[model samples]
Target chain A: MSIPLTLVLGGARSGKSRYAEGLVTAGPAPWVYVATAQAFDDEMVARIARHRADRADGWQTVEAPLDLAGALDAAPAGATVLVDCLTLWLTNLMLGEHGITAAIEALEAALDRRAAPVVLVANEVGLGIVPDNALARAFRDEAGRLNQRLAARAGRVLFLAAGLPLTLK
Target chain B: MSIPLTLVLGGARSGKSRYAEGLVTAGPAPWVYVATAQAFDDEMVARIARHRADRADGWQTVEAPLDLAGALDAAPAGATVLVDCLTLWLTNLMLGEHGITAAIEALEAALDRRAAPVVLVANEVGLGIVPDNALARAFRDEAGRLNQRLAARAGRVLFLAAGLPLTLK
Candidate 1:
């Protein structure tokens, strides 16, 4: 079967990450954890450690704070690749002045070429009050657009909250 | 004068989080950091820790992975408050059988009651490929609708990438 891509999305602390981990653990083939976070300080270092401790011993971890497509290229075929989160990755790209259109194309191309199942993690940001500042409001708009693009490509979608998972794909 | 509500948005690692923190640090009152992340494992713990270390001293931190409205309500009026991100929060609400309409209403109401300048962080997810799954497609659609609604009401909008901020509101 062609690789299936699942998108896991939720608010912070809504159990999206946990749910995504479970899905990979239960699925077939070699499991790989593709982490998008960079350790900028002590708090992040500890957070990364905790995540490492939580994963199964067999799971291989790949730290790709910005170059996701390149990271995916390095993953073996027939493996199960779980991207810890896409939001952080996107943030990295956006801040670098990388073309959003090109970055997205690279990700999709990699996904299409990969033979393993891909699960992407993301956050949903539009269900809140309108922001009053220009910068904040613009970000909300862009995030909404990006989420739409990723979700459209995902084969399955799940929303998590309170450690609960709901299938939306 | 009413307290201004700011929406901060960017792709992952775009320095939006740090930027948000800077905005709050510049505020006149003691700032509050409303965290929405949950530690299900070591990785998340490290992520949270990194965020904590990034903050300056004397900032009150509140961990509310869910129940954002309640957290907002609990914050003292006239105190500068920062919601680390909204995408996760929305996913939290949506995963628990919460309809988009209700969630938006609740957020709007809570925002109306706030007396301090509130800075909200969110990730941009719409600038990518169309998902193949129904659930992800639905999320994308809903997020878009929600962002549009919020943007209509927000006083300011900004897009950040590579730590650079662009005004759009």
Candidate 2:
């Protein structure tokens, strides 16, 4: 059977990530987690550690700070794979000075080739006032574009608010 | 007939304000625009000006920098009242050493007393990585709480993404 893809979108503390994790864990065992976050600071390190502690044993974690497409290709077939977030992956790519256009194309291709069910988490960052800085504005615009693209490709999309899930697709 | 209260939420540049304006304009001839923004910078001045220019005549604008409840109470009955935002008013209250708890209480009370059809706009800012600063984190938390309260009280809540409105209530 073809694996269905789902996208979970929410603001910070909206429980989107938890919801996505629940979806993957509900379907199969020995899940593969594609972690895109990089611990660049103390807070992030603690956050990452907390997430690690939250998951039960039986899950294999891949540190895909970049090369997300490759990480997807590496996952075992018929296994449930969860990409913790796409925004952090985008941030990593931007900070690393990678070709964002080519990276997005590759990531889309990877999603198209996946044999296992996949759940992706992304932040909904475009719903606020325009940031004062040009960099922040650009990032917000880029994130919106990326989300639109991903939402279009996914079989289902869910938006989280106040820790509640509202299916969008 | 009781006037409808609409809560319009979206990310930056998501056309949320425009959408809210459309809602008010669609209902009545004369409109009460309850603007919560304080133009503290040139960019903001330009933004406010742009919004002003975008509207046709017959809009009576109320500059509610801190006294939002009073402004709302003063709006004409049987007219459309659009509160451009709540987050900025919260920021103003926080910065001006005003009591947030009391302000929220007053705002809620005012919403309860409105005699006109009201459409409120607010930014959804709780999504994304946690802010590094304590002040920012506090602000995000407060925004989230305030949004939940207002959303629960609102007759209808709409989340805007990619310029599309998805009704949540």
Candidate 3:
């Protein structure tokens, strides 16, 4: 079967991650977890620690704050690679010297070249009042664009809310 | 000329709102800013105040934390409607009894039925490390999926980073 590309999305407090984890558990092969977060503060540090404790010991955790393309490349073929989230990855790229276009292009290329199933998680942030600040508004705009590109490439799309999964594509 | 549907995306401080305002400033009226956030706390109250103070007198603001389809129906046919962000809207839906699927379907129908040019802003949250907590992971997953569905419907997609926009579609 052709490798399936799954994109999971939801708002805060939604149960998308657990559902995705369940999918990974049921799937085959060497499981790889691609993480994109950088603990910048105490709260984030604690958050990271909590996530680390939740995973199964068998899964190989790859800390990839940025350059997900490279991380995907290094994973062995036939492995189920789960990129925990895309929003943070985009944040790292936006904060980095390399532009957003280049980062997205690289990610798309990596997804296309991969032979294994890839499950990517991201946040839904576009359903609110327009921010008054310049910086907040810009982030929202870019994220909306990035999500569109990734969604178009994904074969399966799911939205989770209140711990429920609703398959969209 | 046909009105263009614009997608604005960003993170917490990525400047997505201000950029969208700039776009509106250059476009035709009657311009409507659809506010999808609810003030549930002191921090949110302050954030909302900050956003309100940033707008020009020419823009008319409409507060609709839920029932976005109804809100869209109230907008003028030829006017420009800017749905500030999608994250908060999803949050509102999750907090409600209708759940994710119904909310998504309603929003999709609204987008399809609307005649006005709609500019949507959202946050991209899938880049970081997998959250150790089940709740955080679930939120990340659902947000990613919602973003994908909306992005697929948007005509133009833009990714913002460090206040810069990279057009992807």
TM-score of chain B of each: 0.90, 0.95, 0.92
Better of 1 and 2 by DockQ: 2
C-alpha TM-score for every candidate: 0.50, 0.60, 0.53
Interface RMSD of each: 13.7, 3.7, 11.1
- Worst lDDT window (10 residues) for model 3 chain A? A126-135
Off by over 4 Å in 1: B1-169
Clashes of 3: 71
DockQ of 1: 0.02
lDDT of 2 by residue, A30-130 (tens): 69999999998886888799888988788999999999999999988767889988999988888888988999999988888887789999988876556
lDDT of 2 by residue, B1-169 (tens): 2447788887777889988988888876679998999999999999999999998788999999899999888887667888888888989998898999999999888877876778889888896544657788778877877777777677888888888888877
Best by TM-score: 2
Q: Which scores better on DockQ, 1 or 3? A: 3
Candidate 1: count of backbone clashes, pairs at least 3 residues apart or interchain: 67
**lDDT comparison, 2 vs 3, better candidate:** 2
Off by over 4 Å in 2: A1-8, A13-157, A162-165, B1-3
Model 3, residue A3: what's the lDDT? 55
lDDT by residue for model 1 (B1-169), tens: 2558777776655567877888888878678889887777775687789889988897999987777788889998878889877766666656666766876788788888987788888776665456666666676567667666666666776665434455668
For model 2, the docking class works out as incorrect
